[model samples]
Target: MIEIDALTKVYGQAQAPAVDEVSLRVPAGSVFGFLGPNGAGKTTTIKMLAGLLTPTSGEVRLGGFDVARQRPAAMAQFGAVLEGSRNVYWSLSAWQNLMYFGRLKGLRKARVAERARDLLTGLGLWDRRDDKVGGFSRGMQQKVAIAAALIADPPIVLLDEPTLGLDVEATRTVKNWITEQSRELGTTVLLTTHQLDVAQELCDRVAVMRRGRLVADLPTRELLAGFRERDRYEIRVEGTVPPGFEAVTREGVTTISVRVSDPGEVYEVVARLRAHGAVLESLTQVQPDLEDVFLALVNEPSHAA
Candidate 1:
């Protein structure tokens, strides 16, 4: 539902582009993760998509409409809650905020009321709907912000750092909302979050950016599987210390780290452990998470250079 083609953003003549020639396509009803380290241009790209910032070159299309030229029609396809919950009013009640935003989106009053009621209640804020946002907790405020974004029932949602300062529980709430939006509601989500676990579990596909350039984009599972260093393993032994083994604390468990390039090397370690009369506890293969992939891409000498 969202298409970007060689989009570029430049602030000054001599300065590097905040967003280079980045191109991407987000399928309808899918959750696409937009990930990068700080200053990687995720925000800049989203702004261009949201019609908040004009791109220096190329184009953005939303719901098949050119966002630059058909801006009103393109913006009608999506609703957004950017960083700091800036889209919502601090003084307005949750109900009022959602209704106002719905009106801004050109939703009919009756439809806005119905959607506002459903969304606020769904987010467990029905009781607080009449309370001023200034009196609500950070989590509560965030929920209201999300409700506002969805009040128009737009087919697409653009969320940037939605769970930024919330506690674990609140973050989980927002993550589940993202999951449900794609899985059950069929809403296309373009998400940018610092939370890797959220991206790993919730996103269908993720695109990693570095220094305004696209580094990697693939299915979440496929992307994570690519980061596995198959030679690395950790084994826990209870009885005796093998001659060449030294225990390292990993997640409160003492594990002997070993690197085996082949099956024979693994067998050699087992043979040595048995020879030492060691009692095997557990054996686990090491796999990298989204954060690992992100760090590897952003910190690469090639990307930096």
Candidate 2:
């Protein structure tokens, strides 16, 4: 539902582009995670997709409409909740905010009212629908903003740090809501966040950026599986670690992690630990998660160079 083609963005007089030839396609009804550290241009790419910023080169299309050439039609295909900004009117009640945004999208009052009720109720904000958003907690306010964004039932949603500062409960609620919208309503989600665990759980596919370039893009499970194939193990012991072993001590337990290219190396490590008079507590294969894979990808020797 979203297509970006060789998208490049260079700020005034800057030698390097903020986003360089970045291209991606997000399938309809799928959750695609856009990940990068600070200044990696994820936000810049998002701004271009939202038509908030003009790209120095290339193009963005939403639901097949070119964002730059068909601004209104492209905009009608998506809704965005950008980070570090208030997405809703603080003085407006939650219901009012939804109605206003829905109407702005050309939705009829009766249709918007029905959607508002359903969205507010689903977001657990129905009770406070009539209350001013300024008086609500940050989580509540965020929920209201999200409701407003979806009030028009746009097919695509651009969410930057949707669960950033929420408490655990609120985070879970938002996460579940995203999943439901994608699974049930066939909504396409383009999510950008620092929360790797959340991305691991929700994103069908993930793309990582570094220095304004696309570094890695793959299905979430495939990415994790590639990292998992590495033979790494974590060994915990009750005594001193031998020389040449990197160990961390915590609560009287010495932990050592090592990667082996050969199965024989496992026994060699165990024998070395035994020779050091260390009482073995446990030995387990290390399973890499999204964070582990992400760090490895972003911190590659080439990236560092």
Candidate 3:
């Protein structure tokens, strides 16, 4: 539902572009994660996609409509929750705020009320439907902001750090809602999150960005495979060690450390140990995780260069 071609955004007075020649495509029913560190042009890219900021160069198409040339048509097909959750008026109750935006989106009074009630109930905000948003906590305000975005039932949802300040329980609620919307309603979601674990759990595919450039784009499985490390096999042996193995003396006992490429290697190492008549005490493998990959990519001097 979304296509970006060579999207570049350069802020005036800045030495370089905030978003540099980035191109991406988000399909109709996929959860696409946009990842980057702070000031890495993630928010700038989202703003350009939302038509809130015109790109210095390139094109952004939303559901067959160019965001810059045909803003009304492009925007009509999408809903968004930007950087902050301050869209609703403080004086109005949650229901009223949704009702107001619903009408503005061209929904009938009855439909607006119905959607407002359903979303509020779905988000567990129905109990405080009559409460002023200003009196609510940050989490509550975020829920209201989400409800406002969903009132129109747009096909594409753009969430920029949806769970930024929410607690664990609240974050889970929002995550569940996002999953349901994409799975049940077939809505296309463009999610931007700093939490790699969240993205790994929720996104079908993730694209890592650094320094305004696309560094890695892969399925979660494939991405995980890239960071998967060889297993470590530790064997404790008695007496003099075999010729090929190096042993370290700890408490007057010799312990050997070997790097096993896979399970088959572990089996071979154990068999060799038996042949040499060395006492084997323990063996274990440590596998790399997503955090390792994230750190490697972000820290690589080549990526920054």
Candidate 4:
């Protein structure tokens, strides 16, 4: 749904570009996560793609329309929730905010009102729809912000840390709604977030950025598998140490860790320990997660901005 090629951006006369030659693609009906540390240019890239900031050099195309060439048409293809959820009028009611954006999207008065109510209710803001946004809490304002984004029901949604500052319940609500939007509505989501857990849970694929460059792009599972540290085992025993396996004791000698290549090696090690009159308690396998891969890629000294 979106394609960015050789995208570069610089602010004023900065020594280095905020976004440097970053290219990305978001396929239709898929969720793509943009990962980076603070000031790594994730927001700059998103802004270029959203046509909010013009690129110094490079091309940004949204749904086949060149973002710089056809700004209006390109923007019409995307809905973005960027930093600061104050995009809506503070004095306007929640429903009023949605209605305003709906009209801005060129919807008729009746259609705008109907869609605003549906979206507000879906986001659990219908009960408070009449309250002024200036009086609503941050989480409530975020819900209304999301409603405003969906007012036009654009095919692509760019969410920058949608659940950044919410409580567990509010985060859950937003996550579930985003999932529903992707699954049932087939909305293509391109999100930039520092929350690795949220990215792991929601993104089909993730691209990690550093120093204004695209460092790694991989499927969440494949990335995790690549970071697997041989496979770890937990053994419980009381007697002597195993012969072939190197064991590290923890938890008051009730637990030990053994790193092995395969389960058969684990079994062999367990048998060796049992030969010394050690009782076997339980065994478990460890798998690497997105955090492991993210750290591995982003911690490189060469990636410094």
Q: Pick the candidate with the highest lDDT.
A: 2
Which pairs in model 2 have colliding backbones?
none
Cα error of candidate 3 at position 146, Å:
0.9
Q: Candidate 4: how large is its RMSD?
A: 3.0
Show pairs that collide, candidate 3.
none
lDDT preference between candidates 1 and 2, better one: 2
Candidate 3, residue 44: lDDT: 89
- Quote the positional error of residue 289 for candidate 3 in Å: 3.4
Instruction: Write one digit per residue (lDDT tens) for candidate 3, span 1-305.
Output: 89999999889888889999999988898899888788778988999999889899999999989998898888888888887648678899999999999998889999999999999999999999999999998888888998998899988999888898999988999999999999999999999988878888899877878888878777767877766665665677666666888679777577887886667887887778778877767665545555667777777857431
- Ranking the candidates on lDDT from highest down gives 2, 1, 3, 4
lDDT of 2 by residue, 65-88 (tens): 999999999989999888999999
Give the Å shift of residue 260 in candidate 3.
4.8
lDDT of 1 by residue, 80-199 (tens): 989954568888899999889889889899999999999987899999889899999888888988898899888999988888889999898898998999999999998899988878
Whole-model Cα lDDT per candidate?
0.87, 0.92, 0.85, 0.84
Model 3 has a clash total of 0
Candidate 1 or 3, higher TM-score? 1
Candidate 4 per-residue lDDT over residues 136-255, each given as its tens digit? 888888888888988988999988899989899999998998899888998999878878899999998889998799888777787777777767877776656655555656664656
The list of candidate 1 runs beyond 4 A from truth reads 249-253, 302-305
RMSD (Å) per prediction: 2.1, 2.3, 4.6, 3.0
Q: Of the pair 2 and 4, which is ahead by lDDT?
A: 2
Question: Model 1 compared with the native: what TM-score?
Answer: 0.95
